[model samples]
Target: MTDTVLVTYGTTNGSTAEIAESVAEVLRKAGLTVESLPARSAPGAARYDAVVVGGGLYAGRWHKDARRFVRRNRVLLADRPVWFFSSGPLDASAAERDIPPVRGVQRAMKRLGVRDHVTFGGCLVDGAKGWVAGMILRSGKGGDFRDFDAIEAWAQGVADALTPAREKRH
Candidate 1:
């Protein structure tokens, strides 16, 4: 069996956290050992066979804390299979346009040699956010755009990449 670490950035309404959890569940059901944690608390990826790093995209940028985690851990992650994802875009049309995928995350993924990368539609509830957060939320056009089926399918790809070579021979 392969061991995996799925780390992500979570936020106030917890939408991104839920997305990360769903991906972790998919990886777990695939018979791999997996760990999921907030990016601020995430550890280096070198100890694992594979890593999946996710971020909540806001204002066309990933959370600062998550970006820093990927930055500090980049060298360690380059040696492992690293998959990158962003929770973004509230609508299918915007998703097609890649709204929240800022360039920093792209650069980080490129530096780490990410095997799979994508953007998952995320969520926003006016009632659930702080004052400043709500103000910023209104400017962008997105809310709960996450497609669970698509998220799972992407995760399955990660699972396939992390699958044991011995298993592949079977």
Candidate 2:
């Protein structure tokens, strides 16, 4: 009865994907079976016992694929333990204000009764591959504000929440 957790993300310049991988790694270390995948390529939600979906914030909106993935899997996600995260906001102090998960995300969360949602600071490398990312970096507003410790701690919390079910089955 071990829970299989799906860690999927949508990203414009790869930062969110990195965050998803980190979360998956932490969950794996905690003894959960985890799968890290892009939202666009994610398999059926029925294949997992729990789900953690994340995406990059762009102009106050989540990556479209992330939103679409949730929409397509609404039935399955609604019946499972689902969580969400957002990776964006260059200013670490402004993580809450800069990327509020948007109204659409909020609505989806409410519908699915999502467990929790977190917002983490994002990365802005000098030569990011996306056009919008490159423009933002060139504007002198790009800097790495990701807090790995916070991400790890959050993943640990997720593992904590999911572990009880496994223990019960044993």
Candidate 3:
């Protein structure tokens, strides 16, 4: 059977889920079979040859379901390649503010032996989301901050990583 890769992620307002779908598309284009699924709806971890997990940041933390998925499959994950990413810290402007959530995510990735990790800016629309999300995104900056180019680049990178080096060469 052809090897399979899993693209799994959790989303608060669906941005991360879109990113995961992008990743899956890139992998599929490169000839690798990929299944994009929400963390909650995904097959148990370790079932695929390679795995990419992503999540949206909520209150400075990853979605609970994403965290649980990693913790539950820590061992199997350590045995194979796993990539992690967090969709967060959508810059409100050149605030020169706090560090990105990716810093903490990196630490977690290291412990899990994740092959790679990334943090991408996301978007929020005033009143478009639920009350909690709306309140947080409203009084603050509200706009679509997701960068499609950045998303595509990340997706391509994942596809490249999945390809054997020898095969990557023309």
Among these predictions, the greatest lDDT belongs to 2
In model 1, state the lDDT of residue 15: 82
For all candidates in order, the CA lDDT equals: 0.74, 0.89, 0.76
Give the alpha carbon lDDT tens digit for every residue of 1-170 in model 2.
35799999998778899999999999999889999999999997998999999988888888887998999999999999999998888886644453456787899999999998988998888768878888888888899888888899989999999988877887
TM-score of each: 0.84, 0.93, 0.85
Candidate 1 TM-score, true structure as reference: 0.84
Residue 136 deviation, candidate 2, in Å? 1.3
Query: Which runs of model 2 end up more than 4 angstroms from their true locations?
Result: 94-99
Residues 1-170, model 1: lDDT tens digits: 34556556645567878888888898888787788888888776666777777777767788776788788878888887788888766667444664435798778877878787778887776675667566756786435678889888888887777666526655
lDDT value, residue 78 of candidate 2: 99
lDDT order of candidates, top first: 2, 3, 1
Which has the better lDDT: candidate 1, or candidate 3? 3
* Candidate 2: 10-residue stretch with minimal lDDT: 92-101
By TM-score: ranked, best first: 2, 3, 1
By TM-score, the better pick of 1 and 3 is 3
